[model samples]
Target: MNSSDGGTATPAASGAPRSGPRASYPAEQSAGSRRRWFVGLSVLVVVVGVALAWLGYTKFATPDVAGEATAYEILNPSTVSVQLTVTRKDPSEPAVCVVRGRSKDGDETGRREILIPGGTQTQIGMRTEVTTSKPPVIGEVFGCTMNVPPYLTQPAT
Candidate 1:
């Protein structure tokens, strides 16, 4: 059958099967599929950005060292020594370090308190001798503490 405008009737009116891609599906359904794909892509991009930010924070969020242990010497049965390289990020920040020694049995044999004056240099190397109760087989640094200890003092003029 033909319509009043002289065009062939659609499958619904003529009762014949439709042909071609657009005729197979409705326009609203195709638009809905496109919207779903766009939403899925947007979610994937946000998840990837969050994951990258977390990785960056975990890799770079720790404090840096104030001082580092450079070397040590087990001089004699009664004495041990350690060499430390101190760093002062702030010129007024004093440095106090605890140097320790260990015996052959892996027991602590000695510990010494060291003080380095601040406002002089960014990095300084110092050596201090430690008294030991027994012969120390090795010497190591426990860690360095910022600022001066209570017992340190300067002589009065």
Candidate 2:
């Protein structure tokens, strides 16, 4: 027997017992390393999947309510007329919007809270006149809030 080729005998020539590819490390150690790598990869994949799901839920799965001022006109020195539209996902929910008037000097001249009655309409269009103490240069809708009516909260008398 020639002691060459790092003593790893070829089965075809030396009749040694071998079945698969040669490994530099022990079979059990290599198998264990592969298993650990597989488990780590699986965990990473799961974590990433969960993170993506949470992000999607927060960004796309929630409802949004918004309002916009469509048009405004200065009726008089202390009065301004405004037209606004409120949009919501659930139209049955009542909304309150704050309207404001600003003077030429950028001071808030008037502010009013307008009530929007709830109905089956998703988009509500409203027109109102805002009164101010000084001459108003512009009128705008600040924002809107969706809430249950106070009449619904009181107990029956």
Candidate 3:
């Protein structure tokens, strides 16, 4: 049979495939795909960066000395004595201690302040002879503001 009459086909081309609408992708589509991929990669990188930043800030950020305070009472008062202990996280700073007392009438009876070096505990002890003929109810409140330096806040090895 003749070739023009649909005889057995022979190999036509050589090194590369033929170029056509179905064989090759459009230039615009290829460029758009690349841009979309780049945008997706950029978004992923930004998300990862933000997550890492949040973790770093939460973990390594300095302790915010916003304010830490606690109150407690000592029972069975004979000779009323107030004691305060302050410890500094850093060795360069100083610890502050204060002792105060309040009477049954809600009056400031006594107060004392002391300072101790950093990385050390300082205690302030005070003794006051209080007479409560009418069943005394002595109230004491300790208030302090502390700022821990950065050097002493190193993470444990």
Q: Candidate 1, residue 156: CA error in Å?
A: 10
Clashes of each: 0, 0, 0
Writing each residue's lDDT as its tens digit, candidate 3 over 14-63 gives: 43443434344443557888999999999999999999999999988763
Best lDDT goes to which candidate? Answer: 2
What TM-score does candidate 2 reach? 0.58
Local distance difference test scores for all models: 0.74, 0.81, 0.46
Whole-model alpha-carbon lDDT for candidate 2: 0.81
Top candidate (TM-score) = 2
**Residue-wise lDDT of candidate 1 within 1-157, one digit each (tens)?**
3443334567535766544554555646578888999999999999999999999998776422255668878788988877888776664666777888889999988998777776657778888888889898877778776746677656535
Candidates 2 and 3, the one with greater lDDT: 2
Q: Is candidate 2 or candidate 3 better by TM-score?
A: 2
| Model 2 stretches with alpha carbons more than 4 Å out | 1-63, 148-157
What are the TM-scores, per candidate, against the unseen true structure?
Answer: 0.55, 0.58, 0.31
- Ranking of all candidate structures by their TM-score, best first: 2, 1, 3
- When 1 and 3 are scored with lDDT, the better candidate is 1
Q: Scored by Cα lDDT, where does model 1 land?
A: 0.74
Task: Tell me how many residue pairs clash in candidate 3.
Answer: 0
